[model samples]
Target chain A: MLQTLTFFALAGLVTIFALGTLVLRNMFHTFLSFLGCLLSVAGVFFSLQADFIGGVQVIVYAGSVAVLIVLALLLINHKSGDLSRTNLWSHKWLGGVIAAVLVGAALFGVIMFTHFTGLPLTGETAAIEPVPYIELADGLLNQYPVAFEAMAMLLLAALVAAIITTQADDKADKKAE
Target chain B: MEFVNNIFVNIADLCRALFVWLLNLLGLPVGLAEVAMVAVYWLGIVIVCVFCALFYVIWERKLAGYIQRRPGPNRLGPNGWFHTVGDAIKLVMKEDIVPDGADKNVHLLAALLAFVPPMLALAAMPFGEGMTALDLELGVVYIMAVTTLASLPVLCAGYASNNKFAMMGAMRVVNQAISYEVPQALCILSVIMVAGTFNLNQIIDWQTGNIWLVCLQPVAFVVYLITALAECNRAPFDLPEGESELTAGVFTEYSGMRYALFYLAEYCNMFVAAGLATTLFLGGFTGPFLPGWVWFLLKTFVIMSFFIWVRWSFPRIRADHVLTFCWKVLVPLMLANVLVTGVVVYLLA
Candidate 1:
């Protein structure tokens, strides 16, 4: 009973902050409110028994990464302090309404039949005894080695791209100097 | 991997038993034991965080000082042990100043925000057998998910500061975070695949007979560690808070206690990252002769010390260089590593 109440409370907090994110006039405030919404969403994740992913949501979403985004945003000096993108919201409200309607319809379609029968365990409480984390590690490295190789390449690519982007700016700054 | 999962499942059974017993007992009466346990859990987290942050700060400074061949905080406590504590006190006592035009509440919240998520993530970390704070059935998943909350507060601090450097740092964070997150998750999945379970306790258990996953998944371990460093924004990749350029990056406008919180959060983050890496790759709490908690602490600290060493040794890479290194260098390497692992595993089986 208490768990359900906490879930609702957290979900409500998320909704409220999300609404605030949209309604706030200040662009920065919007981001700030969105952070609040994200944190509460993490709370919802916790309520749903997905603690590991929830922690990632907090650290990756709320920690260094989001800070880096805001830090990037702060680097660009604006022409004015006013964050109001006049007429943009008014024009987009209909689009939002249409999106909301579509989303609601989709949710309505799925709410009635919560289970796709014959599927594996669906209940959050339906116990699947946790296999150890190392088994997963072994499976990756020794068992499913090809996928591991592919993942390495992916990270390498991300690194290269990040370096190139930052290095170009460094060159520009140095050239200016 | 099978053994690890079995162990975690067994441990979970015991935890459920204990919790059920406690709940049953609690249903009838309220005891100080419950409160003490709760306090111990949270307090353990807090004190450990405080000590980790404290030691990391002082340790980093001393390291930096040593590398630079200059004296660092030698006067506070012997070898400057109390330097961070003094600094903490000083920051706490300083005036809390809010910018006149900035939204006060958002700015205020941003300071405290970065500190919480890491602690929450810490809740599910397995310490040897049956020694963890909230053993989620989905322990590994829980740690990963809870950590996602941490990125937002960074963005919050940046935007609320109304500073250009902070904003740029925040934007880079968002972009880099999303990009790197994919690989981190994938690499983590590789570990999960081996164990056939997401529970961290199970992962640890899988290695009880001295079967550390690092021997088998060395490539995955390396990729994950590199990504973890980048994920934590350490050293060469720490563009967001690059001292030379950003003047403290997202934390520029923060002052006094707010700055302190960000500072504390930074070290806690570093510790958390190291802790997770140790848990995932280095056989969390699986050492000989020591208690589980001690083994866990020792391993995590050893990893933490390594990060500190690397930070002091390496020169800060350019902002673009940091990103490119991850994408072009780290990502591709990890991907190829994953592919090789997959193919080999299939053939062997």
Candidate 2:
């Protein structure tokens, strides 16, 4: 009962905020609404009892990523776009239709799988107790060391790529001078 | 250990059990009782925040006065014990002003964003054995994550106010707070590697009858202290709120209750930082010959006073120096400490 209530509450919040992000006219307000969407999704993770992932969601996604987005927005210093040109059946109509169809297909897939497989209607996937954090760490480090190493390597590569691009931009500016 | 077990731990548990029993007797559903427990837990944390702010604000002033050889707030009650409460009332009575150009909703939300995170972080703070409001398994990570939210309100207040100084201060705060967090997290990782758990209670438990992590990882201790000072925006790391340059910085346009909430949050953040330092390094609530809670308070105050003293004594660092020092010096030092500590812990085990 508690899980269902939490799911509905958080799901409603997520939907509202996601729509707010799309509907808001002001750019900064849109960013704030997007942050609300991210946080409500984190709440969904918490309600699902994936505490570790929920925490990482807050720390990594809502905290760092959202701040980075705001900072990027600040750098551009752009305000609200012109609302006069937002006709629904204009040049972007195909993009909207395709996005809606994609979302509908995903939803249909989820509903069909759950209905046909006799799975729980609620969001939880399994009844087993959560693997303790220690065991999770142990499994990652010992059992799936290669996967862990690959993840770390991917992050390192991203860092290096970012530094290289910034350096290249600086050198190009120097050359232009 | 005996002192700790016999004091607030038992009392806290007994009070909780009694509350649960009373709710059950009143024919409340178990779920309602659980919700009530969580509510009481958060309420207790907020009460602690207010209580800490009340005492620590005055304590900070009194200590500052003594260090500077002057009396501080000696008029209200005995030695101005009521000064903070009086100031709080004054703040409540004062008119709240939002600048004409301010984004009203964002400004309001900024004050709340600034105020709530420190209180939330306090929920993980352990006063004594079993005395935490919520003893989650990932207490350390939870504290770090919640405390990171502190920077957001500064950003919001800066942007929403549409003020130049506020904007500059907010930008500086983002850089300082985010950069210092790296060293802070690394320092915490060293302690976690040693204690082998993220639970604050379990970390303290590991320190019982053992040398505290400070002794084991002194470099990390120093790094943690510096980063913590930076984290709380206390001087000499308080460049973001530099009075000489920015005139109260991100809170330049704030007034009355909004200002008071910011003030309360700052002091509460100080208490939280000092409490964390004490727990991780000084072996929280573990001392000879005193009640556990009293010892905890004493150690926490000692660390807090050190912060106050440093704030009074040192000049503020330059804005550029703040980021450079953390990234170039503290981060590397903390990284090395964590690496060495990991090796040592592994060898010993």
Chain B TM-score for each model? Answer: 0.87, 0.94
Candidate 1 chain B: 10-residue stretch with minimal lDDT = B28-37
lDDT of 2 by residue, B149-206 (tens): 7888888888888788888888888888888889999988999999988889889989
lDDT of each: 0.73, 0.83
Worst ten in a row by lDDT for model 1 chain A: A117-126
What lDDT score is found at residue B73 in candidate 1?
A: 82
| Candidate 2: segments with Cα more than 4 A from true spot | A78-128, A163-177, B1-26
Which digits, one per residue and each the tens of the lDDT, describe model 1 over residues A1-177? 445567669878999998887777765666667777877887876666555446667766765454555555545636543445532355667777888899999998887668543212233433433334456668988998999999999999998999999999999999999
Candidate 2: tens digits of C-alpha lDDT, residues A120-165: 2444545625437788888999999999999999999999999999
Q: Whose lDDT is greatest here?
A: 2
**Every prediction: chain A TM-score:** 0.60, 0.70
For candidate 1, the per-residue lDDT at B304 reads 78
Worst 10 residues of 2 chain B by lDDT: B3-12
